[model samples]
Target: MPGKPNPVARLFWTAAIGCPFGLWYGPPAFAATGLALTLVLMRHLGRPRRFRARVRRIARAHAETLALRRRQESFSDAYGNRIEDGWLRERAYFLDRTVLPQIGPRFADLAESERNRMLAIVEAEAAAVALPEEDEAPGDGIDYERYCAERLARAGWRAHRTPPSGDQGADIVAVRDGLRLIVQCKRLAKPVGNAAVQEAAAALRYWAGDRAAVVSNAGFTPAARRLAAATGVLLLHHDALDDIDLAGAHRS
Candidate 1:
């Protein structure tokens, strides 16, 4: 107001600085004097209402971006949950001998190889159908254990036969292309429980390698799968191994 320039005030300030500089220096110095004058011109042109509106618009845009980011994270978490749950339910249905049609389209949409893998998991659960109790011996658990390890070996892992020796939770200690992997093999006729998962996770710390895995002929329960996922263990069902490519196994 009284302190600074309006348009008329700007012209007056310009004339004041330029007139003094021109009287002392030359008109060329007037150009340098104009710079300081431009500042006064800007103050004269300033409209508080328009400036506040622009600031409000910018703040609204920033808030919208933050909201969008939060929504995206929510969607991501939901998608992950859906995938895990789908896998868990489908696995259980297949093992229970529920018809494929009853299992829904998600299971139907699986590729041929993936379907075979899932079937293998179901087949592993078919312990009642495959091997007899009278035919089984004390160490016969090694056969299924080997089957699990061989499947991993096929899938570019260097799998070893480390049968459960009753000392620790893990059954196999494998290395895939130099990264060490510890795996516990559970040959169960029924669904695996959370206790087995917790035991395997605890044994992971004893592993001298990079990863820990738990494999079961009978698939893991949803709670067990969640625990395995949270702990970074590869929770594999026996059927999952059917998809492994054993010939090109990577063991470094």
Candidate 2:
């Protein structure tokens, strides 16, 4: 495989081609050949760089395409599972079978190391593609709270739902590894705001818990994130309940 075209080699070829035409057609032909050579050099010199950029664009497109197809398939399944994990798992296979064929011919003359570098670019770009977020939550707020509690229980936490009324802003109370956590569950179409963060922080103090978190199906507002950060409260996606780090949560 060939490496990038050398500048000296390009100049040599330009002269080789132009000299013959110049000899036959005088100074006019020589000047025209020089101009054409300049344009060719300008464009062809960046071929490798342009090719790498093209590879990144193609990789992202292929990744998004695969994610969309997986999401569509998930709609028909009983669980309505998230497609992000599946997309990541199948990324390499999809790239080899679909993405490579479209761009592989261009890399035919690249050195093995250069080819590997290009593949690395493709992998990074594909990995950077954002998968669609899981938007569907349970039917109502109470169910959503219960759902979060159940997920925490499965993750080895001793978790239970608080009473529907007079719970003092805590939807769930979870304990694991000698740390008690107060969680406020919010299931809303819109993003959770600073009020939820405030509520969770207050609940943590009220319950005398070590840590506090606000778990939501929808994302949190910027204000909420800022408030959570200031109050040492965690604003989390529901999926993150599975891997709660008790010691880490207390420190943070």
Candidate 3:
């Protein structure tokens, strides 16, 4: 036989089940206590969500949570690629996963200057890496020269590729703020040497330009760096050529 119900449970069951029926036929006290307790417990546990609309309403209120989900989307929009694990990819991911959560929906509520400062960190970190290699760059000389010109133009310098012949030694001529710059582009797999810098210095004079620079897709040798410094020519490696700020030079 099943064990007899305990006294406490027996009384609880009496109060719980009898309370409702008591209104119709059971004793007043049982009905009153049972019905009251059942209602109270139901309220405490809360009713099951009545419909999907309630869920939709809750999701709409969490705008910060929604914005954070766009991290990969923002990365793709800016960089033309998906997010991944590495210095270049993870740098922006860290900011998005960590700092942006704290800023949340109130991000736009902050003062303009503070917002710009915070976002500048993200944008710069997003752009700091991911330069293409020389082997990955265009093979054609004219195409490579055009590529360099386009890269400088994007970096806020007005750059144009020089004519194939009788263009002095520079491949690109960039001007900003009345300053003419003779740019020597050495698009080779080998690291650039002092020879490129020397050429830039000569081209600076030959082109009657106020400034000179040597840009290469491979990077500069130590000798090239030293000679560039001595000759007052700016030496830009492949990475620097793409990401360097020419607007600062324009201001100077």
Q: So what's the TM-score on candidate 1?
A: 0.41
Among these predictions, the greatest lDDT belongs to 2
Candidate 2 residue pairs in backbone clash: none
- Model 1, runs deviating above 4 Å: 1-88, 91-139, 163-167, 242-252
| Residues 1-252, model 1: lDDT tens digits | 232224675688678868788778987778777766787666545543333333334334334322322221121121233223323354444334443434334333332434545444443333223221221212346776777677778777777765446537777777766677777777754546777777777777876657666765445666876776677666664544544322331110
**For residues 1-252, what per-residue lDDT tens digits would candidate 2 score against the true structure?**
354456667778888999899999999989988987887788776767777776677777666655443442222222554424323334555556665577566554542435666557655765566776854558588989888998999899999898888888999999998899999998765657899888899999988999999887656666876787788898776766878765463211
Q: What is the C-alpha RMSD of each candidate to the true structure, in Å?
A: 21.7, 11.3, 16.4
Candidate 3: pairs in clash = 15-34, 19-31
Per-model CA lDDT versus the true structure: 0.53, 0.71, 0.57
Q: Compared with the true structure, what per-residue lDDT tens digits does model 3 show for residues 1-252? A: 132223456457656676567666757765577667667566433422211223233333442333332221222213344432222233344445555454444332332334344444444444443433323456566787887888778777799888899877899988877778788877664556888888889989998888888765555566876787677888664345555554333110
Error of 3 at 30 (Å): 76
What order do you get sorting by lDDT, best first?
2, 3, 1
**Clashes per candidate, residues 3 or more apart or on different chains:** 4, 0, 2
Candidate 3 whole-model C-alpha lDDT, 0 to 1 = 0.57
Ranking of candidates on TM-score, top first? 2, 3, 1
Number of clashing residue pairs, candidate 3: 2
